[model samples]
Target: MLNSINTNPGALLALQNLNATNTELTTTQSRINTGKKIANAKDNGAIWSMAKMQSASSSSLNAVKDSLQRGQSTIDVALAAGDTITDLLMKMKEKALAASDTSLNSTSLKALKADFDSLRDQITKAAENAKFNGVSLVAGSAKPLVFLANADGGNFTVNAQTLGLQGLGLSTTGTTFTTAAEAGSMISKMTAALLTATNKLSALGTASTGLDTHLTFIGKLQDSLDAGVGNLVDADLAKESAKLQSLQTKQQLGVQALSIANQSPQSILSLFKG
Candidate 1:
C-alpha cells in the first residue's frame, strides 16, 4: 500500500470487479425475463444455431402431419362409400335370387327388376359423391393422392388407394337378367363380384390402418424432438431464481467494496488536517 493521492490501485481493482459483477447480473436478468438460456446468438452462437435447426425440423414434420391428415380424410370418405356400396351389393344379390324363382308372377318379377335397377343407380351415385377436397378416390379417377412421410420430402411418399365399384367387377347395369336360365347364370357372376368387392374392401381397410399406425408414430416422434430442442435451449427457472438472489447480494457487496476503496484516498487528507 502506498500513501499517495495520485493513484489508487485498490480503487481501480474494485471498479473492475464491480463492472464484472454488473455484467453477470445483466445476463442473469435476461435469462429470468426471457426464460431462455440461449435467447440469441449473443448468448451462445453454437447453441443458438443448433436450436434453430431443430426448430426448423419440427416445423417440417408438422407439415407432414398436415398432409397425412388430409389423406386420412380422403381415405375415410372412400371407405364410407365402399361400405354403402357393399350394402347395396347385398340387396342386389337378394333381388337376383328372387328373380331366379321360376314360379314368380310376372308382376312380382317386374317389381324386383325395378328395385334392382334403382339400387344400381344408387351405387353409381355413391361412388360419384365419395369425394374430398376435389379428390375422388372411388370415382375411377387417375388422380393419385400422395402424402409426405418425412421432412425433406425427397424419398418419402405414400400413395393413397382409389376405389371404384364398376372397376371391381361389380355390374352397374340391372338389365343382365331376362329369363329364369339367365337369372341363374347371374348368380355365379354376382357371387364373384361380391367376393372381389369384399377383397377390395379388406385391402382398403389395411391401407387405412397403416396410415393410422404411422400417424401415431409421427406424433410420438414429434414430441420427442420437441423435448430435445427444449433441453438445448430452455432455462432452468429454479436455478435462475437462486442465482438472482446471490447476484443481488454480491452486487451490493461490490458497491460497498468500491466505496471503501475510494475512502483510502481520503486518508491522505488526515495527514494534512492539522
Candidate 2:
C-alpha cells in the first residue's frame, strides 16, 4: 500500500521523528529561558494561587512593621522629654530651697525667683517640642494610637501605636514664696510638684518598655516575611544547574534519533539498486 509518487514510508517516518524532536527542543528552550517549571497560571494553578496568597500576607505584615517602627520613635521622644522634665523640676526645687534661706534679702530672693521661672519655661518648652515628624505626643494634644480592626483576612493593622505624656501642669504664681513665714510652705508645694513629675516619668518608662517588646515582635515578623518572599522568587542555582544538564542530554539524544530516522530512506535506496 505504498504511495510512491507522493510519499515514501521511510521519509514520512523521518519527518515524524523530526517533528517530535523539534517539540522537545522547544519545550526545553522555554524552561531554560524562564528558569521556572511553572511560568504561567495554566502551568500550576494551585501553586500559583498559594504563592499569591503568601505575597499578599507578606505585604500586610510589612506595613505593620513600618507602623511599629514609627511607634518606637515616638515613644523614644516622649521618654526623653519626660526625663528632662523630671530633672528640671528637681532643679527648681533646689533653687526654691535656696531662696527660702533667711540670710538672702529681697533682692537675692527676686533673682532666685527669676531662675525658678526660667526653669519652668524650659520644662514647658521641652514638653511642647517633643514631637516626631510633626506628631506631638507630650503636649496633651495626642492620644494613644490604636490599630484598627482587620477585616481582609489579615492579622495586622496599618496604624501605629501612639505614646504620649499626660497630667503635667505648670504654674507661674510666686505668692507662696514671697512671704517670710511661708518659706516652708513654698518648699512643700514645689516638693509636691516634683513628686508628681517623678511619678509620671516612672509610668512613661514602663509604657516605653512595653512598646520595646512589641517592637521586637514586629521586627521578627518582618524578617520572616522577607525570607518567605525570597523563597517564592529566589532561584536555587544548584537545582537549575542539574535541570540544565539533564535537558542538554535529552536534547542530544533527540537529535541522534532524528538523524537516524532521516537516514532510514537510504536503506530503501540500496534495496532498489541491488
Best model number under lDDT = 1
Whole-model lDDT, candidate 2?
Answer: 0.63
What TM-score, to 2 decimals, does candidate 2 have?
Answer: 0.77
TM-score of each: 0.94, 0.77
Local accuracy of candidate 1 as per-residue lDDT tens digits, 1-274: 7887889999899999989989988988999999888899988999999989988888788888888888788888888988987787778778888899999888888888788778767777887888888876677663556787778883323343434555556555533676666666766766776677677677667767887887778888888888988999899999999998998998999999999999999988888887
Q: In order, how many clashes per candidate? A: 0, 1
Give the clashing residue pairs of candidate 1, or none: none
**Candidate that would win on TM-score:** 1
Q: What is the lDDT, from 0 to 100, of the residue 200 in candidate 1?
A: 69
In Å, residue 199's CA in model 1 sits off its true spot by 1.1
lDDT of 2 by residue, 1-274 (tens): 5535345665566567667756655655565677555566776687666667766776776566566577667767876887787787778778878887888889988788778778877776787788887765566555555431122433322222221223443465542366434555666766777677677656656666765676677567657766775565445656766766776676677667667756655665665785
Candidate 2, 43: how far from true, in Å? 3.1
Model 2, residue 98: displacement in angstroms? Answer: 1.0
